[model samples]
Target: MFSQSVRSFTKQALQWSRIKLVHQRITLTKFTTLFFYLALFNCIILIALQTVAFVDNEDATEIITGFLNQANVTQDHIIYISNNELLKCKDLPSLSDANCETWLQEDDGDDDNDSNDSKSRRSLGGFFSARSVSVPRHHSENAKTEKYSNGTISGLELDNGKVLDTSCIQSLIWLNDVIHDSMAEDVVTLVFQIWLFFLSLATILNESLPHLGAAIAGHVLVTAWAGYRIRNTHKLREHYQELIVHQVCEGVDFLGAWWDVRTDHTIPILVFNVIAFVLATYLATRLYRVYARETFNRVRASPRLHKIYKLVLVLSVCVQLSGFFTVAATAMWLDKASTGSINRVAKHLVLYRAVFSTMAVLEIPWAILGWICIRSENRRQFWIFAGISVLLLASSSAIFASPLYQFIFQTWPFFASMTIVSYLLILVITVLGVWSRTQFGKGLPEFLKEEEKLEGADFAPVYIPDLKDRKSFDSEKGHGSDIDTEPIASLPPLLASQPLHKPPPAEKRYRTSSVYSDINRDTVKLSSTPPLAQAILSEQSPVSDCPPTPNRSNFETASRSPLSRTPGDRSERSRNSLPGNPRPINIQESSSGRPGRTGLIRI
Candidate 1:
């Protein structure tokens, strides 16, 4: 009864073990499907939000252009003011004479007429028609001469004896440029998001750890970019508000109204950014979990080089991520410094942009090559990767020593810090990559391939014949014993019940070349022998039925018993007993009517 219960328990355990593997496979499939759908939804929503942002940017540009036109502000006027340092009425020498009051009165009348005309035109024109107004050309050369001499200057004196400051005009121009840049950034981001969406789909289809890692890197980049844009927008708004509070201008009310409209449009984008960031973070975490689990499995398969391989992968990801952020920050810094008061040569800026952009763009391909090299243990690819790393390191170092280094530190300290961090990370990756190159081709790739095959086999479907069909088939094959009729799940327990004193039939024995072949063959042999052999061998020997298991043993036994002789030995003995030159023996028919040969087979 106890043995029967053990058999039942073992059968149930085998069934449950198979069920567990199926359940895990099903769960993973469901998870990947859900992730793919969620990512698609995210991509759709981002597209809508970016579309709205693009429209808002267009509207803001039109509004700014309309306001500039109504104020009669031309690019030439702005350039003239900037070049002459004409900031206020006190800075204008033409506004300090007794005729200034008369000029102010005339200017006020002319401004009233211009305002009336602008209002009529605006009323007649459509929404974007504000930009359609042809700006009157300004005589910057004449203005320059009038500023130094005593020539009368037009539009210098305003109502209340105040002159328009360049600060307000500069702020408006800056804001317009910011909006345009935001629009461009939106387009770029939209493209990147689309690329990421497809990458995610590929990741789901292939379930590749490296692909998942790349997706996570993309998510991090998008999230950081969104945050940076948000911060920059907030700074722009604050600067505009500060200008309105400190300076008195005729367009202040218009600016406030336009700003309110712009803010309303911006709020939706902010909400979208928040949602995108949340989704990105969630997806990144999920992908990271998957990546880490797969990486763990691969590492476990090849533990000899696991430490170095894992470190290389980790450093490669870090390098890619840092490289992306560094490029972004450097671009932002370039934009800010190029528009700032600092005097930088154009050639230097172009060089800086080119170098950083190239490095950033190469990061992805470099990481891919590194992964391939590591997996395939390709020495040539590793050398190429190492050489590129050295070049990038040297180039980065050269950039640090360039003239713009101080400019970056002073103008954009964040960029400077990111550069430093990225440089250090690159250095580490280079060193670790070279070290890992030496440890390649040591059976790690083969181990990983074996692991993949095992996983695939676990998920593969198995067909089990019905019990009645199996029994019929066994009977037809002349193997219809009770052992052959048992279900597969119960066969292991029944085989385990065989007595240990009996050895397996020599015809069924075979050798294996695997490292663990001895253990595996011994286990299979012990479980496959007939139970009756135990009783017969024990009764003849007068020893216990079960013997202690040995660590290692050969299947071939030389006990001189008929059952113990191998097939080859038996055949050779028959040939020798056939009335030959060296040896001969007699064969006779037994009572069972079967010809029997009696002889000892010697090895």
Candidate 2:
């Protein structure tokens, strides 16, 4: 009786342990579900935009002074320029009389040379000076002037103009001497404070209209023919839309001097994030297949590719830093026609921004890679970090910063554009993730070995279906948050269902993976597929070769009801798997916690 009681107690403990483990797992999953994507949804709109109406005429006056200085410096200097022109008056030859600078002809004799010298001396009466050149100005506001680089004003006029700081881009162009006429200046001439009043009215009206119409429409659509399904799908669509709106509408939606910080220092820091985003999304994405997927497996075992990956990592960091420089450029150049003192200050803003945020955006990929390396048990921790990293990047880029916000706040124009770029950034991140996953899935014998070991196990009971030919895994049914088709559907009673021996407890938790080892280091031979052909990616892998998963009894069962596939766990395994021409996987999963992983793998 004692022995029997001990056995019963042991059985109950084991069962209780499993239940507790499951409960803990469920709680962790729910926590991750609540936090990870919630943060992602919140981050879509944290852009700062506030309009500062420039009341000072000093900045405008300074711009005019610089132009006048430039005109004065170049006016008297005779220019024989087409492709290039002398930047400083001193660089030009001193004019002599009616005939300016002329190349000396040695054979023309000393008399002609002397005559030429005299002509040159005559023209050099007013040796290049700041007072030489002038800018042409009309008598009044309506004066029409054409062909302005050579035009100059004899007298100085300091006109004070007011503009929204958001109008900085147009202002920059005007200052750069890009716009040659007063007509271009007229755009900023109108009083815009009245528009603010109208804007307030519109905001009120927009608020007054209770979105009940939209809400009712959503309910009616959900209730019509397919209530459960329509409601779910409709809700999903609405949620996605709300997510976007939330991103776009984050923070104090006021654009009045909110960007004064850009005018001060944080400009280049912002620019760095922009650059990282652009290169990671635009440049890195282009070669991601070659670097991450194509060459990754080949270099998995080679120290050379590791160095290359490190190089890529370094380059990515550099590009992020480069983004800071781009912002620095913005800071310096985002001003109106200003003098060297102002431009110099702008450049300092760039450098300052760089030093500040170098680590923030630079660590984005490292955070992503960390999540990639996490074991499933600890996945939630890593994913939280991943979400944080992505959010940091989004905030850094100002993806939610809109031009309208800038219009109100009078700041850098690109800040608003930067908000929109978050979409591209997310897409790029998705691409990088897919490429990484795909590379991981395809290459390294170790990865294959893990899949094989899992396949051989009776406890987990995973089926290795032929996935190389399909677009993606078709079975999204699973016990996890990943949104993949045919993902793991939890453990089945495989040992009881069939007369198969379960592996010893010691062997169950782990297996040796040689994915990174024992590859032919000779010239690689690529797998043959048409230039454009579809292929499936599987997280399900095998050891060197997984022993056939099919039960021997499957063939001999007497009453085989046509071997119909089960509704759940009824999919066909690969009938005849092909030899792998292994490459690295490149896939990016989402934090959305949908039915499956986003599986952002590419061809």
Candidate 3:
């Protein structure tokens, strides 16, 4: 009685433990699901904010242009100043004819008449002296302006009747170029953000480790980029403010105001970026923990296969990272090369951008395909991915060898370095992809499939047929009652005359059926048994030849031998069978419709 009570308590304890484990699993899953969606919501908000910021930056060009027009500045005036190198007029012979020293002498002579007028005149004189250029009166139509680099400039006039010098015109030109470049960068950043949003969505929905890693890496890269842009913009603002302080250009104040507005717009974006980065980091950490648990389980299940899976997973993540960098590098190159003043020998800028962008986007699909091929061991996908990788490799090489390389390098050395890094990463990814393909049929795929099955087992439903009306059900099907049914074949006379044997222990009877039925049957076929026992086994009809047992439940029928005739025993036994009685001989039918022994009947 004490043993029985102890056993009952132990069973209840085990049941409670199982329940607690299940509850923990469910709670963890719910927690992760909630946080995943929260992160996605944050991403959606970021996308909307970024889109607004992009549109605002894009419209800044028109705003700057309108401001320049209001200030009586034309595109031609800025271009003429840039092309003519008018800012260094002191070095020009034509501008040297008007003596800047005469204006300074005149301003100094009037210092006592009116101090305010003298200060303004002195400032004007000092501006000219700083550039070492003459104060120009209106240029007569007959005046010959020296040709500088590309265009010949006569003079620039502001609405205030003040002749604009090179410093003022150059500031306006710089402002226009900065706005244009900012617009281009906005476009690039917008596109990348869109890509990142979809990548994040996929990672959340698929719960894939590789996609999670890629999304995390993307967030970090974009955050760093945002910080860089903010810092650079601040520096440009300071530089323009210095120009305003020195009163170098008449329009420097307008440019400074525009910079202030641009900075205000960018501050919000940076705030959103930092918030998104934090969310991404949190989500990635949780995902990695879950991934580690699953990985640990897989390793315990199959170490060799897990090793291969680990390698493939690492390589797949690297491929994904490479693809992302490739896109980023291409975008940077496009941004720089497109905004450059220098003309490229390869005039198909649009075509080049399209081709490189397409190739960069294709890297993502290639990485996904490589992962699929490795997991599924699909040779067709393997070959397709390999072929695409090779083509991309060739295209990348051609790009390096093309004139675009020099254009990009000349435009921005940073872009050139990023491109080189992207190329090397791609090379590494391609090599790893080919290597991963070789790991096909190495049991990793099967192991993963089995793991999925085991994880899903808790949700699988069980069906138990009703057995209360079994006799009527069997009768309606034109089958005799199972209880009244006679044996289809009689035992051999020699074995029938032998004494009945005591049944095997209850524990042996309760053991679950082995999956290796064929191996058991083969063992029965080769075993040496007494002639009488063998005769009795041979005389019993095959399981398929007998009518179905309607009285027994499906679970009981599956657990016990079909030949058991008594309620007290679940398997038939022969007395004096080999020493130390083993399991009863199960006379089941083979797939070939022959009677076969599946259990050993040792004495």
| 134 Cα displacement, candidate 2 (Å) | 14
Number of the top-ranking candidate, with lDDT as the measure: 3
* C-alpha local distance difference test of each model: 0.51, 0.30, 0.55
Candidate 1 residue 83 Cα shift, in angstroms, is 24
**Comparing candidate 1 with candidate 3, which one achieves the higher TM-score?**
3
Off by over 4 Å in 2: 1-173, 176-385, 393-405, 408-423, 430-603
Winner on TM-score (2 vs 3) = 3
| Positional deviation of residue 413's Cα in model 2 after best superposition, in angstroms | 8.0
lDDT of 1 by residue, 262-320 (tens): 55555665565566556655755655554455546433554656775566567655554
TM-score, ranked from best to worst: 3, 1, 2
Cα lDDT over the full model 2: 0.30
Span of ten consecutive residues with least summed lDDT in model 1: 98-107
True-structure RMSD, every candidate: 18.1, 31.2, 20.0
- Candidate number with the higher TM-score (1 or 2): 1
Clash counts per candidate, in order, are: 0, 85, 4
Clash pairs (backbone) in predicted model 3: 578-603, 579-603, 580-603, 581-603
Query: What tens-digit string does per-residue lDDT give for candidate 2 at 1-603?
Result: 999999999999999987775444323333222322322222221111111112212334344345334334222322221111111121212212224332221122255557645533433332233112342222113222223365543322323221112111111222223212111111221111122223222212222111212222212221231223223323322221222111221211111122232233233323432432333233222223222332334222456435434433432332332232233322332332133222321324454345335534444454444433432223455456456546545544561243222321232222333223333444454344334433433233454345345434556333333345122222122133243663334336663455544444643333322223425422222233232322222323322232222222322231221111111111212221112222222221223333221111011
Task: Encode model 3's per-residue lDDT on 1-603: one tens digit a residue.
Answer: 999999999999999987775444433454345545655666677667667666666665565455444344443321212211222221111232322121111123343668745544555556434433222222222222332376644334534454545445444554565556566566656666777766665565445677777777777767777788778776555444334323454432442244455667788778888887887687578667655555455335567676777777777776766666677777776665565232222356777788788887787788778768877888998898888788778888887655555534533433554567677767876887777777777777777677666555666222221366445434332344545233323557787677677767755543323324334332222223345555455555433212332222332332433432211122333332324433443433344455434332222
